[model samples]
Target: MKLARAIHFDESDMRVYASPARTGEWCISGGFEFSNWTEGDLTGKPRQAFANGWLGLETFGRATFVAVTALEPAELEALTDLLAEHFVTYYGAPSAEAARPVAQEEIGQMVELCEDHAPNTLLTVARELTESGVREAYRVIESSDAGLDQFAIHGSLDDEPHHH
Candidate 1:
């Protein structure tokens, strides 16, 4: 399967990349940059500039990763809808009740694997959680004690001396 990532940096720029995880594996997907606009500036009703567009394209078979500086309540809802669309597109259909168990199981397996080997790479852990068919699994792991420990260990490793 072809994996794509759309990262929204702040409220100004949107970086869309395809297969950014691997080296020398570039794809035709390019990034989309957005201009910054205040609540009142967008539609004159206090709305996000990219909310509609982002939510509209969420139903396709694309994996989007949003990284915003600040997220509001309305924006959260929009993001949730986008995630739901992503799940439905990637999996089969939209059924949170049915997807929850599978998502949880995938997250559990990711936790176990990270604890066993790559305990010093939280980003790797997060990526693994995402790739394991569990959308937003990082949020669950981030809220767990084990996940916090793993993050600390990963941080410590980053601060350690490099022998290579």
Candidate 2:
């Protein structure tokens, strides 16, 4: 998905950081960046546009990991896994193997996997994005879900992160 070069953040204090858009992991960039954000938080409906069934993740402070993104619960979950898999893919098998493999068949295990991998995935994404350049980083992180691109943050989503 494509986005305006100038990313709009709801929070006045939010900042932008750069990270490279690498191959094999590019598919997970959108979600990974949003999930691994350090300087900001996430806000939902009635506040930042989640009322439309789309969630937003915004950046905060003078240094930001991700600016903002609006996505569905399903897409969030899917992207969570994608980020995890990307973690495993980039970091090799040892670390990922230690984090518990994603059990695709069992809903319960899947939930657990998401819980377990979120932190690691975020860290991994953050590390990679550190040198990717804000413009390219934000550009790639516009949307993870196909057909659901182009979202705006009318308010701050970088103060607190939440789960739907």
Using lDDT as the measure, the top candidate is 1
Backbone steric clashes in candidate 1, count: 0
TM-score of 1: 0.27
RMSD after Cα superposition, model 1: 15.9
Query: On residues 1-164, what C-alpha lDDT tens digit does candidate 2 reach at each position?
Result: 21111222333212112222211121222332243433234343211211111111121111222222223467545544554454466545455344234412222322332342211121112222244432221222323321112222322344455443
Candidate 1 residue 155 Cα shift, in angstroms, is: 9.0
Worst 10 residues of 1 by lDDT: 24-33
lDDT of 1 by residue, 29-57 (tens): 11111233333443421122223222223
Q: Candidates' TM-scores?
A: 0.27, 0.25
Stretches off by above 4 angstroms in model 1 are 1-17, 21-85, 121-164
